[model samples]
Target: MVEAARILFGEHGFHGTGMAQIADASGIRVGQIYRDFESKEDIIAAMVAADLSDFLDEAVLAQAIAMGDRQRVRRWVLDLMIRKQQPNDSTLLPEILAEASRNPRVAAIMREGDQRIRRHVAAALAMLAPHAESACARCVEELMMTLMMGGCSRRMALVEGDWQFLEGCMARFLDQQIAWLADHDDGAAAADHADA
Candidate 1:
């Protein structure tokens, strides 16, 4: 049902798609669909949860951190910032955002998903810079999220020109931020040792 909704939502905006359409696409009865999901918002929540699950495989980051692989951790953060979006995502995300502006339920769902992603980002930042202030991590997190979302908008807008150059610039920016975090944290650690 969620898959069907995703396709329909991508083709048509959130308000454009209907439960009957989802049921028809999924080959499920409308009653059965209702049994699983109360409304389109419910389906949206499930879709977001599934996407988050696929993206936030914590074990990968945990393993990298456990091995003290700073490079891997940095790569992980960089990948999150510049990950490729699925074709459907490019179509569907904007639709959802538009609907979210009018629907309180959808807005709440988006907020919760955003918070989950933010927490995951914060954890990755902390692993990269254990001594860095939370405020610093948060600033990095906000910037990364903005760039990520902006990339999605850029693709959706069908901007002309070479994307690789833009991607390279983004990667360099993130690399510098990560390096600053590492260097700043090291300095803070040394200061603590001196105080001790």
Candidate 2:
């Protein structure tokens, strides 16, 4: 039932899919779905959680944590964003975002996911950026997320691998973030940035 909802939601979106259709796709009775999930929203919420955990797991997050160099952190941020910005991911996320906008329940789930990622990013910054707490840290985090969310939507529908441009943009954004951080305190920034 959960798998059915993911595919249906991923394909037709939350608004377009019906419980009956999901049951049919999953080869389960509609009533059986209710036994597991209270409503479509519940199912979608689970899917969102699963997706978030699946995408940003401990292994990947650990690498981000182990990194401490400013230039390296910037490159790592871009590389991570590029990897997560697969075409289908951006396409599916907007539908979820739009659904979230109309439904408070959905919005809550989305916001939770966003908060989790933000905290993860912030922690990574703190480790590699002991001296960066002001605008520079926030800007780095925001730019990385923005590049991921925006680039996914913009480049998802393209053919022939257009994400290379997004990779370049991410690299540039990282460079800017590094320079901005360096200006605050180069020695401390460099020391934290060089974490192996």
Candidate 3:
């Protein structure tokens, strides 16, 4: 049923697709879907959750862990914004966002997912900039993430190659972050003072 739903959902936006089409594609009796899922919305939510779980867990987080502090934070965010574009990865969240523009329920779900990703970004930044609290680090991380996201999309629209402009932007952004940290690195300052 889900396989059918995936195809139908992918082909048409969530609101445009119907359960009958899903049943037809699945070659299962339409009622069987009900036995498995309560409603179309339920199936949509389930499909979205299932599709996102693997990319978010494996490709995204694993990539972040392998990266350095600034790269980890940038990649952590880039992963969220582009995880859908990954080959063989589902674009469910983007679809959900589109659906949410008209659907309060879907909008709420996407908002919740957005919040989770924001927290994950905050955590990644905290790992990179441990001298700063989560709140402080997240402010910077969110700004960079938003910049990368908007920049990548615009760059992709104008460019034809697989561009990894993130590293250069991150380096520049990190330089700024480092300068700020140098001036306010209480931990390092305290250690220096203690050593003195």
Relative to the true structure, how large is the alpha-carbon lDDT of every model?
Answer: 0.83, 0.72, 0.62
For residues 1-196, write the lDDT of model 3, one tens digit per residue. Answer: 7767766776686777887888888998888888988777777677656755754564555566566546655555555544435331244445655777887776676666656656666666555666764445656767856764565454434445444555555556665764564455558667888999
Clashes of 3: 0
Q: Number of the top candidate by TM-score?
A: 1
Q: How many Å off is the CA of 177 in candidate 1? A: 1.0
lDDT of 1 at 183: 66
Candidate 3 residue pairs that clash: none
> On residues 76-186, what C-alpha lDDT tens digit does candidate 1 reach at each position?
777676676767987888888988999999999999989988887887888877877666777888998898778768778877747778778877998788777776675
Q: Give the clashing pairs for model 2.
A: 68-193, 69-193, 70-193
Q: Each model's TM-score, in the order given?
A: 0.88, 0.78, 0.67
TM value for model 1? 0.88
Task: Write the number of the candidate with greater lDDT, choosing between 2 and 3.
Answer: 2
- Alpha-carbon RMSD, each predicted model: 2.6, 5.5, 5.0
Instruction: Rate residue 67 of model 2 by lDDT.
Output: 59
Model 3 per-residue lDDT at 42: 76
lDDT of 1 at 86: 69
